[model samples]
Target chain A: EAGVTQFPSHSVIEKGQTVTLRCDPISGHDNLYWYRRVMGKEIKFLLHFVKESKQDESGMPNNRFLAERTGGTYSTLKVQPAELEDSGVYFCASSPGGDSPLHFGNGTRLTVT
Target chain B: SQQGEEDPQALSIQEGENATMNCSYKTSINNLQWYRQNSGRGLVHLILIRSNEREKHSGRLRVTLDTSKKSSSLLITASRAADTASYFCATRDPGAGSYQLTFGKGTKLSVIP
Candidate 1:
């Protein structure tokens, strides 16, 4: 089966601009998650989705960040009015369910200047 | 907050040698997992070791978990140049209902040919 896939492997935007990153999980996977790694920092969890319903979003950084999973399939992470600090790699992952290990995508590298 | 910290932030070894990375966590975990990420790429799950298990192996990878010390180690035997990447250890809290994972800073390994 194909692994999780993310689009626009790299993105460059100016501060205050809006950027959207997309992720398509493996077929039949119901659990989707978002994560990010800033320069010199460990990868941090952003949020999670279980079949279009947010399972957890406590890790979201702020109100400017939003995520959506429509039709219980693919997911999108949007950063409005992006800031210089928002420049980093945004990763998306998926799993079948329960405690299964996650499969990740190549991630989208966003550079906000 | 970061749950785990990897030892020896970076390592370099020649091919056919062994590379070991250690991770120390602050709390109890349901399971510990190792992942490898090539530069500019997403992470790939290497293996998972439960709290109760002591050791597990997959191909050239060997993982050891020591609950008593709240630490874990990953060893790649007969390493090859292709194994060059950053290796990270992630943990899932036993009491956390959410499946989000807490990751360590990671160890960057350079395998020379």
Candidate 2:
């Protein structure tokens, strides 16, 4: 089976712009997660979705970021008025269920200058 | 503060040698997982060890968890040059709730040919 796939492996945009990253999870996987890694930092969880409902979103950094998994098949993370601090790698992962190993995508590297 | 911290920020060894990495976490966790990421690639799940389990092995990889100490170790025997990448330890802490995973900074391992 194909692994999780992320769109636009790398994106460069000016600060204050809007960017959207997409992720397609593995087939039959109902659990999806979003994480990010800033420069020289550990990967941090952003949010999680169990099907179409969000199970956790406490990791979201600010109101400028929004994530949605409509219909429980794929996910998209949108950052409005992106800031310089938003430059990092955004990773999306999927798992069979709770307590299962996650399968990740190549990640979308966002560079907001 | 981050929940998990990986010791030895970087490691280098000759092929055919053994490589070991350690991770320490604060608070109780349901399970801990090890992941590998090659340059410019997504993370790949290496192995997972539950709090109740002490040690587990997969081919050349060996993982040991000490819940009492709140630490874990990953051992890769007969390492190959292809193994050069970053190894991260992620913990599923019950305190975090919702099956969220907290990741360590990771150990960048370089296996010399």
Candidate 3:
């Protein structure tokens, strides 16, 4: 089976711009998650989706960040008015279910200057 | 709040030797997991030890979890140059769902061949 896939392996945008990162999870996987690693910081969870419904989004940093999983197939993370601090790698991961381990994509490295 | 903290931010070892990384968390967890990532690459799941279990093994990897102490350790035996990567420890709390995981800064392991 194909692993999780992410688009635009790298993205560069000026501060205050909007950027959207995409993720395609493995086929038949019911769980999708978003994470990010800022410079010199640990990877942090953003949110999770289960079959088009957000199961948890408490990790989302603020309202400027929006995550959606439509049709229960793929997911997208959009950051509006991005700040310099948002420059980092945005990772997408998928798992079969709650008990299964996750598989991550190469991630979209966003650079907000 | 990142709950997991990994000790020895980085480690250097020789090929054919053993590498051990430790992790400690503050809150109760349902499961603890370890992941590895090559430079600029996605993370790969290594092992998962549930709170109810003390030890688990996969291939050359061994993981131990101590619920009372809220800590875990990952051991990679007969390490190879291929083992050079960042190893992160993640914790999933009860009812936090799989996406609510909090990850540590990770231990950068360099295996000199």
Candidate 4:
């Protein structure tokens, strides 16, 4: 089976611009998660989706960031008025749920200049 | 905030040798998982050990969890150059009320051939 796939492996945008990252989870997986790793920092959770419903979005950093999992098959993360500090690698993962391991995608590396 | 802390931050081992990395988490967890990421690649799940499991092994990879100490260790036997990558420990905390895994600042392992 194909693993989780992310779009635009690398993205570069200017500060104050908007950027969106996409993730397609593995088939039959009900749980999708978003995480990011800033330079010199640990990977932190952003949000989670369970079949089109937002399960946990407490990890979202600010209002400027938005995530949606429409149809529960794929997810998109958008950052409006992006700041230089928002540059990082955004990773998407999916699982069958209930203590199962997650399958991750090759993250989208966003560079805000 | 990062819940799991990986020791050594980095590691270097010669081929045919063994590599061991440790992770300590702050909260009670249901299970702990280890992942590997090669340069410019997505994270690949390596192993998972439940709170009730003391030791689990798959091929050359071995994981041990000590829930009492809130710590876990990953051991890679007969390391090869291909094993060179960043190894991360992620914990699934039950209290977090979500399936999102809390990751640590990974240990960068360099396997010298």
Q: lDDT per model, in order?
A: 0.94, 0.95, 0.92, 0.93
User: Interface root mean square deviation of every model, in Å?
Assistant: 0.9, 0.8, 1.5, 0.7
Per-candidate TM-scores read 0.98, 0.98, 0.96, 0.97
Q: Candidate 2, overall lDDT?
A: 0.95
DockQ head-to-head 2 vs 4, winner: 2
For model 1, residues A8-105, the per-residue Cα lDDT tens digits are 89999999999999999999999999999998999999999999999999899999999999999999999998999999999999999877889999
Residues A9-90 of candidate 3: C-alpha lDDT, one tens digit per residue:
9999999999999999999999999999998998999898888999988889999999989899999999999999899999
- How well does each candidate reproduce the native contacts, as fnat? 0.78, 0.93, 0.85, 0.88
Which numbered prediction scores highest in lDDT against the true structure? 2
Steric clash pairs (candidate 2): none
- lDDT (Cα, 0-100) at B6 in candidate 2: 86
Scored by DockQ, the top model is: 2
- Candidate 1 residue lDDT tens string, B1-113: 35788987999999999999999999999999999999988899999999989999999999999999999999999999999999999999877657999998899999999
Tell me the alpha-carbon RMSD of every candidate: 1.1, 0.9, 1.3, 1.2
The model with the greater DockQ, 2 or 3, is 2
Candidate 3's iRMSD: 1.5
DockQ of each: 0.82, 0.90, 0.76, 0.89
Model 1, runs deviating above 4 Å: none
Clash number for every model?
0, 0, 0, 0
Candidate 3 chain B lowest-lDDT run of ten: B92-101
Of candidate 3 chain A, the 10-residue stretch with the lowest lDDT total is A93-102
